[model samples]
Target: MRFGIGFVGFACLAASGAFAKGSIDIGRAVYVERTREGVRELEPATSLKAGDKVVLVVEWRAQSPDRRFTVQSAVPRDLAFQRAGSDAIEVSTDGGRNWGELGTLRIGSRLASAEDVTHLRLRVVGRQRGRMTFSAVVR
Candidate 1:
């Protein structure tokens, strides 16, 4: 599965459309940790497989200062989210519409765990650029 990070879709983090001429560009890269010939290395996941330790790197740059917008990225269907770099990040189990803390979110009667997370939400504000890294294991 591909890392299809949802940079194209912007949601409301706090205040939206405050800037008239700001642009955001996102870049995604996937790498798998592996060992070969008694050496450890990270290689492009050309042949993704189950149980592979994968890292999803997301980088974004905002052209204007003090731009507040939402950025969301979906966890690949073949991967299970382990964690992201931010403790203040939000997780969406039901797509990107609804989001909350992982253990606090409920899917019906059950609590939504990291395994149930379908997308990750990060609010971008008070900065011109940022990077987010997520660790996951392919399922």
Candidate 2:
């Protein structure tokens, strides 16, 4: 697993007049099946191939108590977004220019597919091959 801290800072400076600190942590695990443990909680592997599910675990925390946070991460160009685990996430296909829920997002007239996703952003990051980056802000 590779992890990188993209950015961390405060938001809503004009409203609160105080800075809030936040951070993002990222980790990766390749999917594996264990007969006793069942499906989703499989063991972690270092490498993965196509058609294999990879899991990315991200942790976001805010040092301030009363602030809302917006955390985002850059998905590597190679991985596809798995819609099942990402219900609360907002995604972007246009290089972060726009964002929407998975169901409402569209590329041209066609609804966005996992293949069309360029960014999977939420409070968490997905695990994939190569180095990954993540950022967070507290407002």
Candidate 3:
């Protein structure tokens, strides 16, 4: 009876971990051009130390029609940041599992400019030791 219970407990823990990894689809497509006009992935090649902060900027041109877009970011395990506006641009510290409002920048319309730049700032927590990935979606 003891062995059976232990086996089930271990199985449950393993399953939970597998489920968490499966929840993330890092396989999502990435753009391969210099136009800066598609879903882009941003992250540091090396793991970040705690209390470290990095500025991530996304530059793109939204074609006319003035539509709303959603940007999703997956914060790596053990990092946190305060998001500042809208869904068009967002920030996350938990590996993209959850996101908070960061800020917003207009995309399409006469008001759009080729030189417009959108910025998101993220602070890395020392307690966390892993790579964080960010994704931006423009529709």
Candidate 4:
């Protein structure tokens, strides 16, 4: 009985450690305004470790006539871009001073739509230790 209990405890600890090591926490920090046409606001702020692959997911309503949006990344100087999309997004390694196109999200024929989600992925590279900001503009 003692052996069985110890084995189960060891297994539980190992499982938790594995989960913690592989976990990436993504959070949203923004005030979203809703309209009859759609919703609008900046993308949520995210905190990620250096050299971590961060996938940003933005969810909003597309009820407005504006079918266009812009996503921007304000990255620290030390990080390098692995990949990004253009038309819908731009990435800046210099903290929003200059930006290059990254990615795009297509709404297709859907306009004045609501309750839609858009996703973007960025690989986070560690340069210096600090916080960075990212945003999305829908006009």
Q: Which predicted model would earn the best lDDT?
A: 1
Model 4 spans > 4 angstroms off: 1-52, 67-69, 76-81, 85-88, 101-139
How well does candidate 1 match the true structure in TM-score terms? 0.77
TM-score of each: 0.77, 0.57, 0.26, 0.27
Q: Global lDDT of each model?
A: 0.71, 0.44, 0.28, 0.28
Give lDDT tens digits, candidate 4, residues 64-121: 3232223223322222334333333444333344444432222444331111222222
Question: Can you write out model 1's per-residue Cα lDDT over 1-139, one digit (the tens) per residue?
Answer: 5433232122212223432334776666777889899998887666666678877777777877677876667876767889887876788889777978878899999998888988886888887888777788878
Residue 73, model 3: Cα distance from true site in angstroms: 2.1
**CA deviation > 4 Å runs, candidate 3:** 1-47, 85-139
- Which ranges in model 1 have alpha carbons more than 4 Å from their true place? 1-22, 36-40
lDDT of 3 by residue, 1-139 (tens): 0111121121111112222434322122222112246754444313233343332222222232232233233322232333332333443332334444432233443332212223232332221122222332221
What's the number of clashes in each of the models?
0, 1, 9, 9
Whichever of 2 and 4 has more lDDT, that candidate is 2
Q: What is the lDDT of residue 90 in candidate 1?
A: 82
